[model samples]
Target: MNQAFRDLFGAKVAGAVASAKALGQVDHSGLKGALREVLVRSLLRPFLPPSIGVGHGIVISAYDDQSTEQDIVIFNRASLPCILIDEESGLFPLESTLFTIEVKSRLNATELEKTHEKAARLEKLRHTPGETTPEHVIPCLFAFETDLVQKTDLHRYQELIGTSDPSIREICVVGQGRWFWTPQGWHHTPPTDTYSEVAGLIDGISSVYERVQATRSRPLLLNYVD
Candidate 1:
């Protein structure tokens, strides 16, 4: 079962990467980026439980602060339906959001720093008062390629990790390796195979979903009322 799961997503990941590269020859970077995001959304939807909705959107707090457009916003559709701004985008309430992901065609130090900053801003968005939800939204960074040297770049990665919000859960660069956070500290898992990197990410998402399921109760949406 595990191998089948890995094989399925691994092929999807390869296909997405191939399609993105084919599109990269075009002059428009935005088109390529958007295609990558769409491909990633397709890969995730089939694997996630039906109750967990996925889309591209901006997450808004009750106070009206909003996250920048997220590449992938995973939320509890069964509990609270997000407002659809359009076919490809929507407005997800902070309390309804499980997590947000920023996808990149390439991962570099500058891009990683920017993602960290974005995650920090997301950490500031307060949920509806007294709502039964995760205290912080998990922020994840996913990239198809990376520019950092595996050995010499360790310090740079560590420095960013040292200062990032604790809610920033995972950074995955497919074909490279992944960095994940735990109560003990950050840990690195070198890529063991083409499929393992993405498989690790799916596993991480499942873990978060399971944890939320164990702790989450019916959210008190009434708390949003004045």
Candidate 2:
């Protein structure tokens, strides 16, 4: 912790600390933006390699020309999701691994398409001349607050994941609800609600981020539905 921040948080910090500690234990339905961000950072920070870095609320350049930016892009997704670019340490550069995360209160096809375009465009830029190419395939993490993804809708999502590059991993976090992660060519049992299930989902999502730098696993699916 920075000295300046610590000084400011002295004495009265215990309350905030307590609240923060309780976040992971809280149900997803009760998750707020602050709490979710805290949880993700806490879980991801530990697994990161010292060489790689992490930031919060950072900008992700999607195209070589800087035409698009995202909430966060780990390395580069100009060509493949979760791929990291060594040229420049931002999204849209060559050889950079990118992880595109979508945290929505709810999701729709339109939103999904937009996210896909962002990832694809970044992938295209990775190889373009004068544009940095990310080395890693970007991964996708979708966290939501809902129960039960519609059967037809599940098929659409499965198709999207199938079309993505093999390096990319897709994980969905559904808060305090019930859902399933069924990609085409694979069958996953429907999720059921239970104690610690939501926390497990969050943990799995964090695991992906921690291991993203070294894995070629298919998009790992994490459904946290009631």
Candidate 3:
């Protein structure tokens, strides 16, 4: 069953990659980035549960603080409705967010630093009128390709994370490898095969969804006070 699942998922990822490469023919960076995001969203939709929603949006805290436009925001649609800002984006409450993803066409040192900065901002967002804030809204980074050498570049990646609280919990450089956070520290796992990378990505997301659902002790709306 697992092998069958991996085979099916790999085919979809391959198609997405081909579409992304085709999009690269366009000279406009903004257009290429937007289309790449669309490709990822479409890739994730069929795999995720219907109760979970996937969209491009900004995450907003109860205090009105907002996260920079996210490439993709995964949220609990079964319990909360995002404020639609447009056809392509919405304003998601921090409490409703399961996670946010930042997609890059190519992973480089500069891009990694930028993703870390965004994750830091996401970690700083606050929820109020409650004893505990939701702990499930993690930040993740994904890239179609990476310019950095995996072994030699590990230090540079670690330096970007520094000694701060980790907000970006999972990262996948498709076909290359992935990095995931644990209580001890960040760990890297090279793909066993091309398809395993996509499997790892999906597994990380599924784990986050389960953790989020497990931690939901009350109505999300109760976190906000007028």
Candidate 4:
């Protein structure tokens, strides 16, 4: 890394450690903003480089009808901005983008259920009437913070992802732990881990960063207006 990058990274680490400590007693709701700052400033920005760099990005804006849930959103310049809806909020808007991400601290039965539900809903919206189908191909990503186990809670999810359409892109599971991913129709299982280990996970599967460059769209409320 260059001197400037090293310096910036050092600063980011310091800020993140401090934020992590300060938010120890706070809830996710209270620390959303600070946590977002940490993810972009510390995790994503520092690791990815310009050549592999996706593109300009932005945080999803709150629509007048719905409450906020997500932390940050990245998109590709040529395509629409990617949307990430909060699992609890169920408030993802219809928009064209290369991909959509569902971030989580860990993966389990409940998490898979929620993800499946959200994916189903988004699929429905894509083919609905009057809804301007996103011009760009859409994909789904799950950023999990745990190692995956086979033939368990994540089995069905794994099956679904493996069988999903090409436009869906490959699913991502990020965490401190590691696991194997055998693409559906394939037999060999490849080892994988967090972005720290798998740098290409984002762009390899879906390049929403491209969409962010072309448009600066934000998530809007379709049904869950509150």
TM-score winner among the candidates?
A: 3
lDDT of 2 by residue, 142-217 (tens): 5443334554334555676675542224545443332223244422323333213333434444555445434332
lDDT of 1 at 145: 73
**Which parts of model 3 are misplaced by more than 4 Å?**
1-4, 129-133, 150-154, 216-225
Candidate 1, poorest ten consecutive residues by summed lDDT: 214-223
Q: In model 4, how large is the Cα lDDT of residue 112? A: 62
Report the alpha-carbon TM-score of model 2 versus the true structure.
Answer: 0.46
Query: Which residue window of length 10 is worst by lDDT in model 2?
Result: 217-226
Task: Report the candidate with higher TM-score, 2 versus 3.
Answer: 3
Q: What is the lDDT of every predicted structure here?
A: 0.74, 0.42, 0.77, 0.39
Query: Model 2 off-target regions past 4 Å?
Result: 1-39, 46-50, 56-67, 75-94, 127-135, 147-149, 158-169, 175-226
Q: Using alpha carbons, what is the TM-score of model 1?
A: 0.86
Order the numbered candidates by lDDT, best leading: 3, 1, 2, 4
- Tens digits of per-residue lDDT, candidate 4, 27-72, equal 6744643453345434554444443222222222232222123333
Cα RMSD of all models vs. native, in order, equals 2.7, 12.6, 2.5, 8.5
lDDT of 1: 0.74
lDDT of 3 by residue, 148-185 (tens): 76452346667766776576788887767778887898
lDDT accuracy of residue 166 in candidate 4: 34
